[model samples]
Target: MPEDLTRTARAEGQPLSETDNVEDMYLTFALGGEDYGVGIGGVTEIVGMQRIMGVPDVPAWIKGVINLRGKVIPLVDVRLRFGMAERAYDDRTVIIVLEVAAAPVGLIVDGVSEVLDIPPAQIDRPGQFGRSRSPVMGLARVGDRVTILLDAEVLVADGDLALPAELEA
Candidate 1:
Protein backbone atom coordinates (compact mmCIF):
# COMPACT_ATOMS: atom_id res chain seq x y z
CA MET A 1 0.00 0.00 0.00
CA PRO A 2 2.85 2.35 0.81
CA GLU A 3 4.45 1.50 -2.51
CA ASP A 4 1.23 2.27 -4.32
CA LEU A 5 1.01 5.67 -2.63
CA THR A 6 4.66 6.30 -3.45
CA ARG A 7 4.09 5.44 -7.10
CA THR A 8 1.01 7.62 -7.34
CA ALA A 9 2.84 10.55 -5.71
CA ARG A 10 5.88 10.10 -7.95
CA ALA A 11 3.80 9.86 -11.10
CA GLU A 12 2.18 13.14 -10.21
CA GLY A 13 5.41 14.68 -8.85
CA GLN A 14 3.78 18.04 -8.29
CA PRO A 15 2.63 19.71 -5.11
CA LEU A 16 -1.11 20.19 -5.11
CA SER A 17 -2.25 23.77 -5.39
CA GLU A 18 -5.49 25.02 -3.88
CA THR A 19 -7.20 24.67 -7.26
CA ASP A 20 -5.99 21.13 -7.79
CA ASN A 21 -8.26 18.09 -7.47
CA VAL A 22 -6.26 16.75 -4.57
CA GLU A 23 -6.69 19.83 -2.42
CA ASP A 24 -8.74 18.04 0.22
CA MET A 25 -6.86 14.80 0.05
CA TYR A 26 -4.83 13.57 2.99
CA LEU A 27 -2.47 10.69 3.53
CA THR A 28 -3.41 9.16 6.85
CA PHE A 29 -1.04 7.19 9.02
CA ALA A 30 -0.85 5.81 12.56
CA LEU A 31 1.25 6.96 15.47
CA GLY A 32 0.95 5.71 19.05
CA GLY A 33 -2.39 4.11 18.23
CA GLU A 34 -3.84 7.44 17.09
CA ASP A 35 -4.66 8.39 13.52
CA TYR A 36 -2.91 11.36 12.00
CA GLY A 37 -3.18 12.95 8.58
CA VAL A 38 -0.98 15.23 6.56
CA GLY A 39 -2.02 17.14 3.47
CA ILE A 40 -1.05 15.12 0.44
CA GLY A 41 0.41 18.16 -1.26
CA GLY A 42 3.65 18.12 0.70
CA VAL A 43 4.12 14.36 0.47
CA THR A 44 6.72 13.21 -2.02
CA GLU A 45 6.65 9.47 -1.40
CA ILE A 46 6.40 6.68 1.19
CA VAL A 47 9.08 4.11 1.70
CA GLY A 48 9.65 1.09 3.91
CA MET A 49 11.96 1.51 6.85
CA GLN A 50 15.63 1.20 6.00
CA ARG A 51 19.01 1.74 7.58
CA ILE A 52 19.30 5.07 9.43
CA MET A 53 22.81 6.43 9.90
CA GLY A 54 23.30 8.15 13.22
CA VAL A 55 24.20 11.81 13.29
CA PRO A 56 25.89 13.67 16.12
CA ASP A 57 24.80 16.78 18.06
CA VAL A 58 21.12 16.54 17.05
CA PRO A 59 17.94 16.14 19.03
CA ALA A 60 17.00 12.60 20.09
CA TRP A 61 13.71 12.85 18.24
CA ILE A 62 15.63 13.55 15.07
CA LYS A 63 16.68 9.93 14.68
CA GLY A 64 19.56 10.46 12.29
CA VAL A 65 19.24 10.19 8.52
CA ILE A 66 18.63 7.78 5.71
CA ASN A 67 20.02 7.66 2.18
CA LEU A 68 17.28 6.94 -0.30
CA ARG A 69 18.63 6.60 -3.83
CA GLY A 70 21.08 9.51 -3.62
CA LYS A 71 19.11 11.85 -1.37
CA VAL A 72 19.94 12.22 2.28
CA ILE A 73 16.76 12.75 4.27
CA PRO A 74 16.62 13.41 7.99
CA LEU A 75 14.28 11.01 9.77
CA VAL A 76 12.01 12.21 12.56
CA ASP A 77 10.53 9.78 15.03
CA VAL A 78 6.96 11.00 15.32
CA ARG A 79 6.41 9.29 18.65
CA LEU A 80 9.43 10.87 20.23
CA ARG A 81 8.60 14.21 18.70
CA PHE A 82 5.16 14.11 20.26
CA GLY A 83 6.51 13.11 23.69
CA MET A 84 5.30 9.54 23.48
CA ALA A 85 7.20 6.49 24.51
CA GLU A 86 9.52 5.14 21.85
CA ARG A 87 8.71 1.78 20.42
CA ALA A 88 10.81 -0.61 18.42
CA TYR A 89 10.44 -0.32 14.68
CA ASP A 90 8.72 -3.26 13.11
CA ASP A 91 7.83 -4.44 9.61
CA ARG A 92 4.83 -2.14 9.60
CA THR A 93 7.04 0.89 10.22
CA VAL A 94 7.57 3.11 7.19
CA ILE A 95 8.81 6.53 6.25
CA ILE A 96 6.53 9.21 4.88
CA VAL A 97 8.74 11.59 2.93
CA LEU A 98 7.56 15.15 2.74
CA GLU A 99 8.74 18.43 1.21
CA VAL A 100 8.55 21.02 3.96
CA ALA A 101 9.89 24.52 3.45
CA ALA A 102 11.70 23.36 0.30
CA ALA A 103 13.65 20.77 2.27
CA PRO A 104 13.00 17.03 2.22
CA VAL A 105 12.14 15.23 5.46
CA GLY A 106 11.05 11.73 6.34
CA LEU A 107 8.69 10.96 9.20
CA ILE A 108 8.81 7.50 10.70
CA VAL A 109 5.33 6.27 11.41
CA ASP A 110 3.91 3.03 12.76
CA GLY A 111 2.11 2.43 9.45
CA VAL A 112 -0.05 4.11 6.87
CA SER A 113 -3.78 3.59 6.69
CA GLU A 114 -4.90 5.03 3.32
CA VAL A 115 -5.38 8.18 1.35
CA LEU A 116 -8.70 9.82 2.18
CA ASP A 117 -10.64 12.61 0.55
CA ILE A 118 -11.97 14.65 3.45
CA PRO A 119 -13.97 17.67 2.42
CA PRO A 120 -13.72 20.97 4.23
CA ALA A 121 -17.18 20.60 5.72
CA GLN A 122 -16.11 17.48 7.55
CA ILE A 123 -13.13 19.19 9.14
CA ASP A 124 -13.24 21.15 12.37
CA ARG A 125 -10.68 23.84 12.99
CA PRO A 126 -8.65 23.41 16.14
CA GLY A 127 -9.18 26.06 18.76
CA GLN A 128 -6.30 28.05 20.18
CA PHE A 129 -5.01 26.09 23.18
CA GLY A 130 -2.76 28.82 24.51
CA ARG A 131 0.26 27.57 22.67
CA SER A 132 2.08 30.04 20.48
CA ARG A 133 1.62 27.68 17.54
CA SER A 134 0.18 24.26 16.94
CA PRO A 135 1.08 21.52 14.55
CA VAL A 136 -2.54 20.48 14.22
CA MET A 137 -4.32 22.19 11.38
CA GLY A 138 -7.74 20.66 12.01
CA LEU A 139 -9.71 17.62 13.04
CA ALA A 140 -11.16 15.57 10.24
CA ARG A 141 -14.27 13.64 11.08
CA VAL A 142 -15.18 10.86 8.71
CA GLY A 143 -18.00 8.70 10.02
CA ASP A 144 -16.89 7.50 13.44
CA ARG A 145 -13.21 8.04 12.76
CA VAL A 146 -11.50 11.23 13.73
CA THR A 147 -8.13 12.06 12.22
CA ILE A 148 -5.81 14.74 13.49
CA LEU A 149 -4.79 16.81 10.52
CA LEU A 150 -1.29 18.11 10.94
CA ASP A 151 0.44 21.05 9.39
CA ALA A 152 3.52 19.39 8.00
CA GLU A 153 5.55 22.57 7.87
CA VAL A 154 4.79 23.37 11.51
CA LEU A 155 5.24 19.77 12.55
CA VAL A 156 8.70 19.72 11.05
CA ALA A 157 9.75 23.17 12.14
CA ASP A 158 8.29 23.16 15.69
CA GLY A 159 11.39 22.71 17.82
CA ASP A 160 14.72 24.33 18.38
CA LEU A 161 16.28 22.41 15.51
CA ALA A 162 16.74 24.47 12.36
CA LEU A 163 16.08 21.74 9.80
CA PRO A 164 16.07 23.52 6.44
CA ALA A 165 19.60 24.84 6.62
CA GLU A 166 21.02 21.74 8.31
CA LEU A 167 19.49 19.08 6.08
CA GLU A 168 21.49 18.02 3.01
CA ALA A 169 19.88 18.35 -0.36
Candidate 2:
Protein backbone atom coordinates (compact mmCIF):
# COMPACT_ATOMS: atom_id res chain seq x y z
CA MET A 1 0.00 0.00 0.00
CA PRO A 2 1.11 3.54 -0.57
CA GLU A 3 2.25 5.49 2.46
CA ASP A 4 -0.50 7.73 3.85
CA LEU A 5 0.50 11.37 4.09
CA THR A 6 -3.02 12.51 4.78
CA ARG A 7 -2.92 12.70 8.54
CA THR A 8 -1.77 15.83 10.23
CA ALA A 9 -2.60 15.50 13.93
CA ARG A 10 -2.55 12.40 16.08
CA ALA A 11 -5.10 11.35 18.69
CA GLU A 12 -3.32 13.30 21.38
CA GLY A 13 -3.51 16.50 19.30
CA GLN A 14 0.15 16.29 18.39
CA PRO A 15 1.23 16.45 14.79
CA LEU A 16 2.27 13.24 13.09
CA SER A 17 5.64 14.78 12.38
CA GLU A 18 7.33 18.14 12.44
CA THR A 19 7.74 18.27 8.68
CA ASP A 20 4.72 16.28 7.62
CA ASN A 21 1.06 17.14 7.68
CA VAL A 22 -2.16 16.36 5.91
CA GLU A 23 -1.53 16.97 2.24
CA ASP A 24 -4.08 17.95 -0.36
CA MET A 25 -3.72 16.03 -3.57
CA TYR A 26 -3.34 17.98 -6.79
CA LEU A 27 -3.64 17.00 -10.44
CA THR A 28 -0.49 18.27 -12.08
CA PHE A 29 -0.20 19.27 -15.74
CA ALA A 30 2.08 21.18 -18.08
CA LEU A 31 1.45 24.58 -19.67
CA GLY A 32 3.92 26.77 -21.48
CA GLY A 33 6.63 24.26 -20.63
CA GLU A 34 6.07 24.72 -16.88
CA ASP A 35 4.41 22.30 -14.50
CA TYR A 36 1.21 23.46 -12.83
CA GLY A 37 -1.16 21.83 -10.40
CA VAL A 38 -4.84 22.03 -9.55
CA GLY A 39 -6.53 20.66 -6.47
CA ILE A 40 -7.84 17.20 -7.26
CA GLY A 41 -11.02 17.81 -5.35
CA GLY A 42 -12.40 19.86 -8.24
CA VAL A 43 -11.03 17.73 -11.06
CA THR A 44 -13.81 15.64 -12.57
CA GLU A 45 -11.66 13.90 -15.17
CA ILE A 46 -8.87 14.24 -17.72
CA VAL A 47 -9.74 13.62 -21.34
CA GLY A 48 -7.63 13.48 -24.45
CA MET A 49 -7.82 16.46 -26.79
CA GLN A 50 -10.84 16.42 -29.05
CA ARG A 51 -12.36 18.58 -31.73
CA ILE A 52 -13.40 22.01 -30.41
CA MET A 53 -15.93 23.99 -32.42
CA GLY A 54 -15.06 27.64 -32.60
CA VAL A 55 -17.35 30.36 -31.28
CA PRO A 56 -17.30 33.99 -32.28
CA ASP A 57 -16.86 37.22 -30.24
CA VAL A 58 -15.08 35.47 -27.37
CA PRO A 59 -11.69 36.03 -25.88
CA ALA A 60 -8.75 34.62 -27.77
CA TRP A 61 -7.97 32.37 -24.83
CA ILE A 62 -11.29 30.64 -25.15
CA LYS A 63 -10.45 27.93 -27.67
CA GLY A 64 -14.10 26.91 -28.13
CA VAL A 65 -16.48 24.36 -26.73
CA ILE A 66 -16.82 20.58 -26.71
CA ASN A 67 -19.74 18.25 -26.28
CA LEU A 68 -18.85 16.01 -23.36
CA ARG A 69 -21.24 13.08 -23.43
CA GLY A 70 -24.51 15.01 -23.69
CA LYS A 71 -23.19 18.17 -22.12
CA VAL A 72 -21.63 21.04 -24.03
CA ILE A 73 -18.79 22.65 -22.14
CA PRO A 74 -16.46 25.51 -22.94
CA LEU A 75 -12.75 24.91 -23.41
CA VAL A 76 -9.98 27.28 -22.48
CA ASP A 77 -6.43 27.00 -23.63
CA VAL A 78 -4.38 27.75 -20.54
CA ARG A 79 -1.36 28.72 -22.56
CA LEU A 80 -3.24 31.45 -24.36
CA ARG A 81 -4.88 32.52 -21.12
CA PHE A 82 -1.40 33.05 -19.71
CA GLY A 83 -0.36 35.04 -22.78
CA MET A 84 2.08 32.35 -23.92
CA ALA A 85 2.74 31.63 -27.57
CA GLU A 86 0.50 28.94 -28.93
CA ARG A 87 1.90 25.68 -30.21
CA ALA A 88 0.31 23.02 -32.35
CA TYR A 89 -1.44 20.30 -30.38
CA ASP A 90 0.33 16.99 -30.43
CA ASP A 91 -0.10 13.63 -28.75
CA ARG A 92 0.85 15.17 -25.43
CA THR A 93 -2.07 17.60 -25.51
CA VAL A 94 -5.00 16.93 -23.17
CA ILE A 95 -8.02 18.58 -21.62
CA ILE A 96 -8.43 18.51 -17.86
CA VAL A 97 -12.14 18.50 -17.06
CA LEU A 98 -12.92 20.43 -13.93
CA GLU A 99 -16.14 21.26 -12.10
CA VAL A 100 -16.01 24.78 -10.83
CA ALA A 101 -18.99 26.54 -9.28
CA ALA A 102 -21.33 23.86 -10.53
CA ALA A 103 -20.11 24.33 -14.12
CA PRO A 104 -17.91 21.94 -16.04
CA VAL A 105 -15.03 23.57 -17.90
CA GLY A 106 -12.07 22.06 -19.68
CA LEU A 107 -8.54 23.37 -19.39
CA ILE A 108 -6.28 22.64 -22.33
CA VAL A 109 -2.79 21.74 -21.21
CA ASP A 110 0.37 20.62 -22.90
CA GLY A 111 0.24 17.34 -21.01
CA VAL A 112 -0.88 15.74 -17.83
CA SER A 113 1.57 15.10 -15.04
CA GLU A 114 1.18 12.82 -12.04
CA VAL A 115 -1.04 13.59 -9.11
CA LEU A 116 0.91 14.82 -6.07
CA ASP A 117 0.20 15.12 -2.38
CA ILE A 118 1.76 18.34 -1.18
CA PRO A 119 1.44 19.50 2.40
CA PRO A 120 0.58 23.09 3.17
CA ALA A 121 4.02 23.60 4.63
CA GLN A 122 5.54 22.71 1.31
CA ILE A 123 3.65 25.45 -0.55
CA ASP A 124 4.90 28.99 -0.49
CA ARG A 125 3.16 32.21 -1.43
CA PRO A 126 4.06 33.67 -4.79
CA GLY A 127 6.85 36.19 -4.21
CA GLN A 128 6.06 38.79 -6.82
CA PHE A 129 3.02 41.02 -7.16
CA GLY A 130 2.70 39.97 -10.78
CA ARG A 131 2.48 36.35 -9.74
CA SER A 132 -0.20 37.26 -7.21
CA ARG A 133 -2.23 38.92 -9.96
CA SER A 134 -2.35 35.65 -11.84
CA PRO A 135 -4.70 32.75 -11.06
CA VAL A 136 -1.99 30.75 -9.33
CA MET A 137 -2.53 30.16 -5.64
CA GLY A 138 1.01 29.31 -4.63
CA LEU A 139 4.22 27.53 -5.51
CA ALA A 140 4.55 23.97 -4.29
CA ARG A 141 7.74 22.02 -3.85
CA VAL A 142 7.30 18.50 -5.14
CA GLY A 143 10.54 16.56 -4.94
CA ASP A 144 13.27 18.56 -6.68
CA ARG A 145 11.00 20.65 -8.89
CA VAL A 146 8.70 23.56 -8.09
CA THR A 147 5.14 23.26 -9.36
CA ILE A 148 2.78 26.16 -9.79
CA LEU A 149 -0.46 25.49 -7.91
CA LEU A 150 -3.37 27.11 -9.72
CA ASP A 151 -6.51 28.49 -8.17
CA ALA A 152 -8.88 26.63 -10.45
CA GLU A 153 -11.99 28.13 -8.94
CA VAL A 154 -10.69 31.59 -9.49
CA LEU A 155 -9.43 30.80 -12.95
CA VAL A 156 -12.78 29.46 -14.06
CA ALA A 157 -14.78 32.07 -12.24
CA ASP A 158 -12.78 34.96 -13.57
CA GLY A 159 -12.96 33.71 -17.13
CA ASP A 160 -14.60 36.26 -19.45
CA LEU A 161 -16.15 33.72 -21.76
CA ALA A 162 -19.73 34.25 -22.81
CA LEU A 163 -21.60 31.02 -22.56
CA PRO A 164 -25.26 30.26 -22.40
CA ALA A 165 -26.86 30.08 -18.96
CA GLU A 166 -27.78 26.45 -19.46
CA LEU A 167 -24.15 25.52 -20.09
CA GLU A 168 -22.99 27.56 -17.09
CA ALA A 169 -25.21 25.45 -14.90
Candidate 3:
Protein backbone atom coordinates (compact mmCIF):
# COMPACT_ATOMS: atom_id res chain seq x y z
CA MET A 1 0.00 0.00 0.00
CA PRO A 2 1.26 3.48 -0.85
CA GLU A 3 0.76 6.60 1.24
CA ASP A 4 -2.05 7.68 -1.09
CA LEU A 5 -4.49 4.71 -1.05
CA THR A 6 -7.82 5.15 0.64
CA ARG A 7 -9.50 2.67 2.97
CA THR A 8 -12.59 2.80 0.80
CA ALA A 9 -13.19 3.60 -2.88
CA ARG A 10 -11.22 6.27 -4.67
CA ALA A 11 -12.69 8.66 -7.21
CA GLU A 12 -10.74 6.89 -9.94
CA GLY A 13 -11.75 3.28 -9.09
CA GLN A 14 -15.39 4.25 -9.70
CA PRO A 15 -15.13 4.29 -13.50
CA LEU A 16 -15.66 1.06 -15.47
CA SER A 17 -13.40 -0.41 -18.05
CA GLU A 18 -13.70 -2.74 -21.03
CA THR A 19 -11.54 -5.23 -19.17
CA ASP A 20 -9.41 -3.82 -16.34
CA ASN A 21 -10.30 -0.69 -14.44
CA VAL A 22 -8.28 2.49 -14.78
CA GLU A 23 -8.62 3.80 -11.22
CA ASP A 24 -7.15 1.48 -8.61
CA MET A 25 -4.70 1.39 -5.74
CA TYR A 26 -2.32 -1.36 -4.74
CA LEU A 27 -0.73 -2.28 -1.40
CA THR A 28 2.86 -3.20 -2.06
CA PHE A 29 4.95 -5.76 -0.17
CA ALA A 30 8.22 -7.59 -0.61
CA LEU A 31 8.99 -11.25 -1.21
CA GLY A 32 12.73 -11.46 -1.59
CA GLY A 33 13.89 -9.36 -4.51
CA GLU A 34 10.48 -9.29 -6.15
CA ASP A 35 7.93 -6.83 -4.85
CA TYR A 36 4.25 -7.79 -5.27
CA GLY A 37 0.99 -5.95 -4.73
CA VAL A 38 -2.70 -6.55 -4.01
CA GLY A 39 -5.70 -4.35 -4.69
CA ILE A 40 -6.29 -1.72 -2.05
CA GLY A 41 -10.00 -2.46 -2.35
CA GLY A 42 -9.61 -5.92 -0.85
CA VAL A 43 -7.37 -4.79 1.93
CA THR A 44 -8.99 -4.68 5.34
CA GLU A 45 -5.95 -3.72 7.35
CA ILE A 46 -2.19 -3.79 7.51
CA VAL A 47 -1.23 -5.22 10.87
CA GLY A 48 2.07 -5.53 12.63
CA MET A 49 3.94 -8.81 13.02
CA GLN A 50 2.00 -11.44 14.91
CA ARG A 51 1.99 -15.07 15.82
CA ILE A 52 0.63 -17.59 13.30
CA MET A 53 -0.11 -21.08 14.53
CA GLY A 54 1.15 -23.94 12.39
CA VAL A 55 -1.26 -26.56 11.19
CA PRO A 56 -0.41 -29.97 9.79
CA ASP A 57 -1.52 -31.38 6.42
CA VAL A 58 -1.66 -27.94 4.85
CA PRO A 59 0.27 -26.73 1.81
CA ALA A 60 3.63 -25.09 2.43
CA TRP A 61 2.19 -21.85 1.19
CA ILE A 62 -0.69 -22.02 3.62
CA LYS A 63 0.94 -20.83 6.82
CA GLY A 64 -2.29 -21.54 8.68
CA VAL A 65 -4.75 -19.28 10.48
CA ILE A 66 -4.52 -16.53 13.06
CA ASN A 67 -6.92 -15.11 15.63
CA LEU A 68 -7.65 -11.65 14.34
CA ARG A 69 -9.70 -10.27 17.20
CA GLY A 70 -12.47 -12.89 17.28
CA LYS A 71 -12.20 -13.76 13.61
CA VAL A 72 -10.17 -16.72 12.44
CA ILE A 73 -8.44 -15.86 9.18
CA PRO A 74 -6.19 -18.11 7.17
CA LEU A 75 -2.64 -16.92 6.58
CA VAL A 76 -0.81 -17.34 3.31
CA ASP A 77 2.91 -16.88 2.93
CA VAL A 78 3.29 -14.68 -0.12
CA ARG A 79 6.79 -15.93 -0.81
CA LEU A 80 5.72 -19.56 -0.78
CA ARG A 81 2.59 -18.68 -2.72
CA PHE A 82 4.88 -17.41 -5.46
CA GLY A 83 7.03 -20.59 -5.26
CA MET A 84 9.91 -18.77 -3.68
CA ALA A 85 12.22 -19.84 -0.87
CA GLU A 86 10.87 -19.78 2.65
CA ARG A 87 12.52 -17.60 5.28
CA ALA A 88 12.15 -17.05 8.97
CA TYR A 89 9.79 -14.40 10.23
CA ASP A 90 11.20 -11.22 11.66
CA ASP A 91 10.21 -7.76 12.83
CA ARG A 92 9.37 -6.68 9.31
CA THR A 93 6.81 -9.46 8.78
CA VAL A 94 3.28 -8.14 8.33
CA ILE A 95 -0.15 -9.62 7.88
CA ILE A 96 -2.13 -7.91 5.17
CA VAL A 97 -5.79 -8.60 5.85
CA LEU A 98 -7.75 -8.78 2.63
CA GLU A 99 -11.13 -9.87 1.31
CA VAL A 100 -11.18 -12.01 -1.79
CA ALA A 101 -14.53 -13.08 -3.21
CA ALA A 102 -15.96 -12.30 0.22
CA ALA A 103 -13.50 -14.53 2.05
CA PRO A 104 -11.07 -12.86 4.39
CA VAL A 105 -7.44 -13.95 4.24
CA GLY A 106 -4.23 -12.66 5.73
CA LEU A 107 -1.17 -12.56 3.53
CA ILE A 108 2.14 -12.81 5.37
CA VAL A 109 4.45 -10.29 3.80
CA ASP A 110 8.02 -9.21 4.24
CA GLY A 111 6.75 -5.74 5.10
CA VAL A 112 4.00 -3.27 4.31
CA SER A 113 5.49 -0.69 2.05
CA GLU A 114 2.75 1.89 1.34
CA VAL A 115 -0.58 2.55 -0.35
CA LEU A 116 -0.35 3.82 -3.90
CA ASP A 117 -2.91 5.27 -6.28
CA ILE A 118 -2.18 4.31 -9.89
CA PRO A 119 -4.23 5.90 -12.61
CA PRO A 120 -5.28 3.87 -15.66
CA ALA A 121 -2.65 5.46 -17.85
CA GLN A 122 0.13 3.74 -15.90
CA ILE A 123 -1.41 0.31 -16.37
CA ASP A 124 -0.77 -2.04 -19.25
CA ARG A 125 -2.48 -5.19 -20.44
CA PRO A 126 -2.14 -8.25 -18.22
CA GLY A 127 0.60 -9.82 -20.31
CA GLN A 128 2.78 -6.75 -20.13
CA PHE A 129 2.16 -6.32 -16.40
CA GLY A 130 2.84 -9.86 -15.21
CA ARG A 131 4.05 -13.28 -16.17
CA SER A 132 2.26 -16.65 -16.59
CA ARG A 133 1.45 -17.34 -12.92
CA SER A 134 -0.30 -14.10 -12.00
CA PRO A 135 -2.19 -11.73 -14.28
CA VAL A 136 -1.75 -8.12 -13.29
CA MET A 137 -3.49 -5.06 -14.73
CA GLY A 138 -1.08 -2.27 -13.86
CA LEU A 139 2.24 -1.25 -12.40
CA ALA A 140 3.33 1.29 -9.76
CA ARG A 141 6.86 2.37 -9.15
CA VAL A 142 7.56 2.89 -5.44
CA GLY A 143 11.05 4.01 -4.64
CA ASP A 144 13.40 1.49 -6.26
CA ARG A 145 10.69 -1.18 -6.53
CA VAL A 146 8.19 -1.81 -9.29
CA THR A 147 5.01 -3.22 -7.76
CA ILE A 148 2.55 -5.13 -9.90
CA LEU A 149 -1.01 -3.92 -9.40
CA LEU A 150 -2.92 -7.14 -8.77
CA ASP A 151 -6.45 -8.02 -9.69
CA ALA A 152 -7.51 -9.36 -6.29
CA GLU A 153 -10.41 -11.59 -7.31
CA VAL A 154 -8.29 -13.71 -9.63
CA LEU A 155 -5.06 -13.50 -7.67
CA VAL A 156 -6.51 -14.55 -4.35
CA ALA A 157 -8.83 -17.33 -5.47
CA ASP A 158 -7.57 -19.18 -8.54
CA GLY A 159 -9.37 -22.36 -9.64
CA ASP A 160 -6.21 -24.38 -9.00
CA LEU A 161 -5.08 -21.80 -6.50
CA ALA A 162 -2.99 -24.13 -4.29
CA LEU A 163 -5.57 -23.93 -1.52
CA PRO A 164 -5.46 -26.49 1.22
CA ALA A 165 -7.35 -29.57 0.07
CA GLU A 166 -9.61 -29.45 3.10
CA LEU A 167 -10.84 -26.00 2.10
CA GLU A 168 -12.54 -27.53 -0.94
CA ALA A 169 -16.30 -27.55 -0.74
Winning candidate number (lDDT):
1
- Output the better candidate (2/3) by TM-score: 2
lDDT value for model 3? 0.66
Mark the regions of model 1 whose C-alpha exceeds 4 Å error after superposition.
1-20, 160-169
Model 1 residue 87 CA deviation in Å: 0.3
Q: Candidate 2, residues 45-119: lDDT per residue as tens digits?
A: 888889998877788888999988977878989998888999999999999998888878899999887666677
Worst 10 residues of 3 by lDDT: 1-10
Give the per-residue Cα lDDT of candidate 2 at 16. 44
Error (Å) of candidate 1 at residue 169 is 8.7
lDDT of 1 by residue, 28-105 (tens): 999988999998888999899999988778888999888898888888899998989999999999999999888789
What TM-score fits each model?
Answer: 0.83, 0.80, 0.71
lDDT of each: 0.81, 0.77, 0.66
lDDT of 3 by residue, 9-59 (tens): 223334433453424656777778676777667788888767777767777
For each of the candidates, the C-alpha root-mean-square deviation to the true structure, in angstroms, is 5.8, 6.0, 6.4
Q: Residue 71 of model 3: what lDDT?
A: 69
Candidate 2 Cα errors over 4 Å, as ranges: 1-23, 131-133, 165-169
Give the higher-lDDT candidate: 2 or 3.
2
Q: Which stretches of candidate 3 lie over 4 Å from their true place?
A: 1-23, 128-135, 141-145, 158-169
Pick the TM-score winner.
1
